[model samples]
Target: MTSRRPLSFWIKWLLLIALVLGIALGVTRALGKRKATSEAARATAESLQKTPTYTLSSTDVVTVQSIELTQTVALSGSVDALQTAAIKARTAGEIQGLSKREGDPVKAGEVVARIDSTEAQARVRQTARQAESAQAQVAIAKRTFDNNQALVRQGFISSTALDTATANLSSAEATHQAALAALDIARKSLADTTLRSPLTGQISARLVQNGERVAIDTRVFDVVDLTGFELEAAIAPADAVAVKVGQTARLTVEGLSEPVQATVARINPSVQAASRSVLVYLRVPALPGMRQGLFAQGHIVIGGVTALAVPVSAVRNDKPQPYVQVVREGAVVHVPLQPGATGLKGTEPMRAVEGLPAGTQLLRAQAGLIREGTAVRLSAPATVSN
Candidate 1:
């Protein structure tokens, strides 16, 4: 400090000091700006994370309720007529007069078709002629026997001759009886050539056409009574035990818009050997447009119980334990469920569950999956006008 220095040197030193201070100030301001930016980014990230991710509608959630749950067993099968008959050819002959086709109405004992009766008629005529000839021979033999008896009484003929005449008369009578029986059989064959409907119903099929030769017991047509119908459904042996006659069912029949009502009419006493299933017959009322062979599927209500339940779809199995997503305190909460008996509430399937109180609102199947601790906002339910 005592040494004399040039003014330029001092100016240079002062300028260097000023440059270092400027750099320090610039660095401090840059660090403060970077810290403020980082804090703002963190705040934005937290806000986004805390915000509600899903806004659910009223229909998206289902409320747990104490309901009378109807336990049911699923079934599917074909619809069959309660009364059906296969019209078969009773005699072997050429088919004729078969005017009835499928869907044609037929009454009881109505002649639906006929076979050619030429051979049958000829047989009948031949047997009848034989019977007449035998009858004539019987008359002649009887007259001879009477004459022989008189001659024996007068001592003109031996008793052996009278016995011979009596034997001849008996033989003639037996021949006549045999001829009569043959004639009756031929007549019956002729009658059988005409096919008759066994029941009052509509024709379901025409297996033969006119002029087609058919053998005895050949299926010619199928007749079905459409006044009522039944469904033959095979059920599991475990479920079949609870099934009983007179239980109600609702069936969705193929090609029919409205659900058909059915009743459990009969259950098979024995299990099917091949499938190890039990056959259950459900009686369905005949309605407009009902037809045989229609596919049907439904459930048989076996029993009912009053319990806390939720929709069957509400139960989720994504985790190791079965659980249902519940809404509580405006957040998604997963409640572990001990699923009990499954049943139906009206037409919707509901499942009985424990570990949840009645009136707990739950996320439906349509709500998809929401993360745990995620916020949710449910729309207000619609108000009904009085």
Candidate 2:
């Protein structure tokens, strides 16, 4: 037993190596479990933070639709008649009778007034008697000249006597021609006793009363043709150039319930020095009760064409380009559109844009208050009647 009991150094070394291996294996297992747990906890915290929350309020959106809109113009103007005449007298006489009073309708060639013509009547009769006397004298001269020729051929009268008779006959013929012309003049004077209307019109004014003495070329009646009336307006220097003959325009009176159509008729070439404006004439479409100088406001159509349009407030220039805010599912969408001509003053009905459906609701109120994706409430529906 003493001989076998000699201890081996190799066995002791083997036992030391085994103990070190066992401790290493135990440390590795514990560290692996702790690292995995840390990774799982980190992933769980990151997931909670990634969830998104919506806090903005929302409003319903609408779509754009098309409608027919009437183009209108408003301008200052006065009413005028197309055919206005200052009826005047051609001859001087006393007013004997008035056939037409103010506001009476008259026909062409109808007598409008009568003059006291007692002298004219006497002159006509006197001229007629003188003409008859001249005619009888011409007949006497003709017989005398015939007799003188007969006598000269028969040699019964002296040549000097025949010459004298011929001379007297020529003088009598000249006087008869003068008397005929005088009769014609007297006849015309008699006819001038009645003043007649040259054209069919309404009597607008009367200058002389019955039994009043009037002078030649005196104004007796004023006639006006109301059928051809017009509206006269002063157009600004900026808008005057666009108006032309035959252009369509609209006329609205303060008391009228409906608008009236009109056509461009004339433009004053002379510019007004004070206002730098031109006078424009618009022929009113056949309408009722259009009197002289009725106050009217007309929209002279400066231009025309169908283009894109949107609310005037909807247009915004954020970066030199006009853009509109579109709200979608609580998200803000910026939409930019091409703008057309600057329109007339009013609540701008529509502006030009792209990528919008026919009925998409757009934000129009408090224009500047809207931003990309900002929640909006339509104070009133952004609806436009075409």
Candidate 3:
């Protein structure tokens, strides 16, 4: 603390210089560390930019080809009867016995049942008696007319009496003829007691049992023609237009392995008043064990037509319209396409795209992440498969 001012000037200057040098050294080290770090970061960035593109493995790219497809129109309905007939008695009589029962098969004119006709027989006998009385009157009048003619010729009878006898004889003859015709008609009607079938079919019902009092024109039985069953169903106007007579179809039944084959038979042009649907009739191809009124599902083929198709996966819906992932220079690009028809039901590749050209190669695997241009590897070597 004593008299230091003059002596401290030189020392102060040297200390100041040392402090400046130390500060400069620290600054220089920091700058060097920062520069090294900056260079390292730049090199890493450049390396990353030069890396290979992200792509799928060769086993991941699945490819399927486009094929010809056809559009299908479908409608549904159930089975029915082709013809139904109710057998009725033509003459009134007691139902004596039945020759055929329900479910029994019979041909046209075959006896189904019989009836007691005791009253019909009695009516025939009464008609015959009337005919015999009229014939006796005609004979008596004819003999008297002949004797009157002989007496007139011998001058013993009047012309007016002969004429009266002749008129009576003619009237009696006409009455006798009318009575005989009535008797014949009554006997013929009595023969109708043997009830017969009007068609070759199975008996569906029996309205009269044996000993039942049946009246004329009474329904005796119900029969259904089962040779070929009719399937009746209603379809929309749009669907009916596609259906024409004789178009082949397939019938699907629950729990049935094989579908029944059939053809379109009739189409009722008049729309239903309530449902506004056209009635359609389909005839199943005859097969044994087929029964009328059996519930069944019907499908009409209409017909098949060929059109371009593609793998459904190839079709991308990401955009407002449909498109596909097209590869370009190891990047992604989207290509737009129009979709068209489909193939047979199961035959249509599930999730398969339709309407592409037949030769078009499409992506069939995971469609996501597939860009327009990306490295692509086929599950099977595409070059070899082609």
Top candidate by lDDT: 1
lDDT of 1 by residue, 1-386 (tens): 69898899999999999999999999999999999999999999999877856788878887777889889999999999999999999899999999999889999999999999999999999999999999999999999999999999999989999999999999999999999999999999999999999999999999999989999999999999999899999999999999999999999999989999899999999999999999999999898989999999999989999988888887899999889888898889998887489888888888888878877888888899888788888787511100
Query: What are the lDDT scores of the predictions, listed in order?
Result: 0.91, 0.72, 0.71
Deviation of model 3 at 129, angstroms:
2.4
Instruction: Rank by TM-score, highest first.
Output: 1, 3, 2
| Tens digits of lDDT, candidate 2, 119-178 | 888998998899899889889988988898899899998889888888888888888889
TM-score of each: 0.83, 0.58, 0.59
Regions more than 4 Å wrong, model 3: 1-73, 81-83, 138-170, 253-257, 308-386
Candidate 1: C-alpha lDDT: 0.91
Pairs of colliding residues, candidate 1 = none
Q: Per-residue CA lDDT of candidate 3, range 58-81, in tens?
A: 433333343334344455665656
lDDT of 1 at 223: 99
